[model samples]
Target: MTRKLTTLLLAATMLLGAVSASHAVDFKIKGVWNMNFEYGSGGNFTERGRSVNGNKAAHVTGWGRYGEDQFEAKSRVRLQLDAVASESLSGTVYFEIGGVTWGRSSKGGALGADGSNVVKIKHSYLDWVVPQTNVKVRMGIQRVFLPDFTTEASQAFDADVAGIVASAPINDNLSLSAFWVRPYNDNWAGDTQSPQNYLDNFDIFGLSAPVRLDGVNVTPWAMLGMFGSNTFRKGDDFYGKNSTGAGALGLAPAVYALKDSKVGRQLADAYSTVLWAGITGEVVKFDPFRVAASFNYGAVDTGVEALNRKGWYSALLAEYKLDWGTPGIYGWYSSGDDDNIKNGSERMPNVEANNESTNAMSSFGTLGTWTLGRDTLIGSTFAGTWGVGARVKDVSFFDKLKQTFHVNILGGTNSPSMAKYIKGAKGVDGHTSFTPDTGTGSADFNSANYYGLYLTSQDYAAEFGVTTTYQIYDNLRMLVEANYIALWLDQSRGVWGGYTATDGSRVGGNSTTDAWNVNVSFIYKF
Candidate 1:
């Protein structure tokens, strides 16, 4: 009798353990892999090896120098894991590896393939619904993009940062969302006089309301930020030294002030305030025809007149869907500087991702080769410029093959005279005295090195591109893309021509050659 009882108890305990195990969280994994081959030329439009005042300036080259390599190859991989516990709770962690160039010894793309540290945590967040309520909250590091309908890319703010986002639905057609993000903190190690961690935090708060009606959707949003005095100080680990700090925000004017010893003393005890607002909407009342538009305005006040910045940006997109493809036209414009240095810049301020290869346009690079070509050569924000483009998207003639064609014309809105104030500005006598103390460095402000080509009223460019894709399998695809850009620069005294050599000579004569690139890619997802 005793032996039988003991056996029964053991069986009961085993069954209970099994039941608990079945109720535990479930894990799911998904990932993507991409490989690419590319060849291109003409990233630098400036004339190299010019002589200034009997002094021959060394031949300076820019990124993607005006030439070509046989061919370059690269690869990237991303994996995401999710832990789900019922419908009310879940957690996600996304990891990324590579985007490493082939044959790069540092990244372990060499023969041995033993890279030191190539893995990164792109995102890690937890989602949970309020107990007995419908409100949902996400907390952790994640992608944060502002509302944008026209280009599907926000011009003012779009990047990954640590924050808390909360959303609640008011009705079937309306919802509210809010977030608080901290982009920089504790980056400044206080000096001997100041205490550790003193006023070195940058924070942003934002809110948006999304509305949906019959065939109409719109969202209105606003954001406010507090920038500490020492948030971007020299020796800061978050952004590097003052000269190169805050580049992602396109805050060149402010950064220049912080870098200059004379100007830095004036803002020693001052902080800054930033504000932005925008509206994005789409009209799809007509089934096959749709229209989208967006307008945004932003401003930054650093308590100093020369460091303030304010401007606006607007864009429109219209498309018609056909049986075989979709055709669309798009345009955008943003305010630009007016050759004034003391009053600050009038161009729109924005936050861009540090990785230039990842900044792409939804209307342009329909495939993954957006960054592999010339799409963002004029800066991802499109500030200080205006453009018009047309595209035929997803044209299909075969079962699993599709193609797209694109053309765009771009022009600058900034005053041509502004060139004389930029860094490296040379006079007819080949003297650099024309350069201003506040906005001297081209790489410091909205220059070619930091952003893309900083165009003036006399500068323009035209772009043409083609993208073709073949679906090889349910989870794999191959793509080929080609892009070309024709550039024209005004070589007059008021434009780039003002930068003359010691003998009053302009290198490259009246014009420079164009730029082009071709890319091939294979992508797999599961």
Candidate 2:
């Protein structure tokens, strides 16, 4: 961190402390802490190796020989302080610390190195209710535009921004909200060699309506965003059409040629829009069945005329209560683009973008439920895929502990499109080619360069898991989980198991692997 940031943090802390000491305000402190360890095994492939003749070198991108038989330690803590001036007004200061490391740390009590653990202010916001009405306003740094599950689990949508949010109740069962946010700001920075890079910013606007029904609840929301950055600034006529008059002669030309030129700035803007609707309801009364569904659509300009930037995803789930536990089933689908959009090649102008948008669902952190197929087959529903899952929760033989079990089977909805996106080819070309990239170990499982984008020739995949939680105390718990996945690939498509060389050479041993993991966690809440 820079000195300026340190000073700002100190000032903010002092301000909060002063508020807490004031007679007009009452404050409360609360937090959650979690510590966990994970172990992974199986599925080890060479990242790169020479062919038998030594004339060809092949690179493979899939499960590599890393992260197997290794133990990982991860921990996180959230601290929050809320100061209330009145029932209608309050302010919050929230801090977070989290990190992951391979193996146990040797340091017994001292801080390890910079970035070994992350500590920062996660939220600082003020909430005020308008007198004589149910209108509330929240302003400052906070969370916005994420799903309920995402917010609760602190997973996919765990992003905070500086913004202002206004919400009003239309009636006892309906409410509306609007917000404007700056997700990224360059206002705080030290002198730099290239100041032009710091001139970019991101702005987001959103509106939502939540309605409550007799047996159901629904929330519909929409968001609009604009990203302005110097990343796209380049030579004249290079970014877009250069319609800003590079043709004009004289002093105007000189002005336009500068690094901070108006022409360059205007060309660095991108726009995107999102729409989502979600529903939760009691489907059956006597037997106690519940259902949930979410639908999402997104469009982006990407500032690239030849690239497609539109996609949609949807998920459905139903649960039933039994004498021993609750059982549920779920299915989801995401759209995909045609193979015409080749990898490493220029797409047609106005190409139809696939529904491969990132983090469309809350996968890993959803409490009491596991998105089995979603987590094992793919990181997200991007790139057009579908799957079905079944889960049972709260199978208890004892009062302090309960077990949950889940199984899932996943398949590609658009195999051709998946091939194109994963292996960067189409039809015969893609089928005959191997991916030229690096594989991942257990540690890099979901990274963008690894499993996030490595679903090449997967004909199908299945996953199963069991989790148990023990209540050590009212506010403390211990959890243990074991998971396994079996992935199958179409060998005819030379894109399985290992990577394809840049020149279309293929290398690898097997096309399938049974990967497994075990996790243990301790959590405390106050």
The numbered model that scores best in TM-score is: 1
Residue 408 in candidate 2, Cα distance off native in Å = 0.8
* Prediction-by-prediction clash tally: 1, 5
Q: Write the per-residue lDDT of candidate 1 for residues 103-204, one digit (tens) a residue.
A: 876655777666645667789999999998889999999888787777666778776789999999999999999999998888777786456677778798
Candidate 1 deviant stretches above 4 angstroms: 1-23, 45-70, 235-241, 254-261, 264-269, 353-375, 426-449, 498-513
lDDT of every predicted structure (CA atoms) = 0.66, 0.48
How many collisions between residues are there in candidate 1? 1
Assess the local accuracy of residue 252 in candidate 1 as a C-alpha lDDT between 0 and 100.
45
Displacement of the residue 100 alpha carbon in candidate 1, Å = 1.7
Per-residue lDDT over 257-319 for candidate 2, one digit per residue giving the tens place of the 0 to 100 score: 112233323432343222223332333434477777666565545443222235455677777
TM-score of each: 0.83, 0.70
Off by over 4 Å in 2: 1-21, 43-69, 100-117, 148-158, 187-199, 229-287, 303-305, 342-377, 380-383, 414-458, 494-512
